[model samples]
Target: MALSQTGIRRWYLVHKWTSLICTAFLLLLCVTGLPLIFHHEIEELTGAHSSIEQVAGGGTASLDTMVEDAKRRAPAQVPGFLFWDSEKPLVAVVTASSLTDQQNIVIHYYDARSGAHVPAPPHDEGVMAFLLDLHKSLLMGLPGTLFLGLIGLIFAVAVVSGVVVYAPFMRKLAFGTVRKDRSPRVRSLDTHNMVGIVTLGWVMVVGLTGLILTMATPIALIWQIDELSEISAPYEGKPPPTRLASLDTAVAAARAAAPGGQKLSSVAWPGTMFSSKHHYMIAFSGETPLTERLIHPAFVDAETGRLTEIRDMPWYVKGLFLSVPLHFGDYGGMPLKIIWALLDIAAIVVLWTGLRLWFGRRRVPIEKRVEELRGGGVPEPAE
Candidate 1:
């Protein structure tokens, strides 16, 4: 089916307004996102990041020992949280209360063997922290995040309208055709359509993923208030244990409860919701793709180190889990990420060219502008 010129013009108008409103913010987001794609690699290259040594005999150090070590390193601050990495047998005890507070989390690198705090190379806090802040919220916090998300939504709509208008423009020209011999405005429009249509799938995925990421805080808040609060109510008002149980014991119990031979991957401590008050939340991963990424959080009873619940995640939780990989392009390795980067750059070009076309069309000569208003003459390009 062919679209009438009137329909095409209507779609073009929609694409123009949508793209113009969102281009600047979208461009800023893309530029900041590019560096964050390889933050891990950059951290490694800078020699500022630290890695913990694994202790032999498969014997894990006590969380109490690590906590004591961390306290000794930062005597004034109390340990707020503990994070354990099973693969490396590493422990990270966070001591920071709040960003504005004088107490800051000084990460202590430890050798699991001697429980000694190892000295780490100096890091440029200014650069790394600035990059992280820019990537997450542009330093404006939730308001900035929601603002960018709205822009992403507009970008998605612009992409759709551009595609709708492309069909009408390309009805005469074949795919990949750029009408260079035509008027300058037509040439620019042709290039915009060609680039925009070809990169549709990639741009759409990126845009939607970005929207999901932006909504993460609000979504998590809703889930916590509506669903998680209810699930956690059963154990509420119960005072946390003064003496913590062995993390290693909880890990073993969690692995034993897993249906297959899924390994216990990580453990979140008490006082934090990731870890239950009565027990450590041990996450397990299996061998298959469907199972490997899916985390089965087995809640271990804090007092006896027994597995309490081995429930699977709900559908929405599962979707949120899978969204991270799709959003970051991390599932397909470096090559796919390169392609994603190229597509992102191409989207910028589409935005720029679309803006040029819209502004160019707006500058029509007085006579032609009058003709267009009267619906009796060809639309004139703006001078």
Candidate 2:
């Protein structure tokens, strides 16, 4: 159904101002996010990542030995977590002066099969990491992240309003129609509408997911205060473990307790924010494409290595985890990444064309613009 004249003008203004407000940041996101869709592949091409060779007989290195190696390298630090690299045959040991230390953190990588230490590239040193930081938080950390989230919300509104305006704009023109013989501004407007319509689904998905991700910090803090508090209540008065059990023992116990088709993703040591003072938090991810991002955490006694309990994350945390792969388009491998990159490029084109239309000199009145939509191919605007 076509919008009434007043309705059309209102929606046109809504689309216009919303697009104008978010266009620049949206462009930045599309540009930075394009490369990030292929981040892993780019890392491989840049040789920034180390690939571990598969060992014969399918034997693997001991987790305990790897932790010892990490400790030897950073004697002053305490191990905070053991993480498995999803895309490679490697493991990472993260250490810091304490669990809550924001600075003075170190990461050590080892071959998952041989336990050979590798000088993995520093996360903050690479171009890809720089791009990622810019894309996620604009290099301003949490404040920047929340700002982008607001931008994303505005972008979503723009997308919806654009769709509403598009229907009336295209009432007389064929779908995907471009009036090349018209003025350059008209041509740009047509192309902008065309591309925006084509990439509507992708824009919404990426925008909403990014908005959700920006709330990660607050969500985590809430989890720590709410669910985490209740889960650790049984051991509330317990002291930090004086003698930690073997890493292998904790991992084995967690794995044995995990349901079928799940593998260990990470282990937060006892006394860390993610775990109780007397228990290790072992997180597991499923093998399937969709389930891989949704993780479950199990608590295990630090000294005895016995499984205490396993629980699925709350809905909000699961939403956070699910958005990661969907936002990056990494879960489906190369094919999906290519699709995401193409859509990102198209989004960039749409934003550019929209900006060109908005910045055109000879401003057409809202009434004239609406008349143009109704009449289809109104004579070119006076130069």
Best by TM-score: 2
lDDT of 2 by residue, 84-104 (tens): 877666788999999877446
Q: Alpha-carbon error at 343 in model 1, in Å?
A: 1.9
- Runs with alpha carbons beyond 4 Å of true place in candidate 1: 1-9, 47-61, 76-91, 98-128, 182-184, 259-261, 273-277, 287-292, 359-361, 364-383
Q: How far in Å is the alpha carbon of 75 misplaced in model 1?
A: 4.0
lDDT by residue (tens digit), candidate 1, 1-383: 56555665677678768988988777777777776666656665663234554454443556567777777777876655554444455555566553223224566655555555556553326565567667657877788788878888888888888677666555555788776766787577667878988888878877887788888777756655764555557778978777766766766777778887675555665545455456666777775545666878788777778777787766666666676767667566688778767777887788778778667765655345333423322243554
Candidate 1 weakest lDDT stretch, 10 residues: 369-378
- Superposition error at 192 for model 2 (Å): 0.8
lDDT of candidate 1? 0.66
Q: What are the TM-scores, per candidate, against the unseen true structure?
A: 0.80, 0.92
What is the TM-score of candidate 1?
0.80
Off by over 4 Å in 2: 54-59, 102-104, 374-379
lDDT of each: 0.66, 0.83
Query: Candidate 2, which ten residues in sequence have the lowest lDDT sum?
Result: 50-59
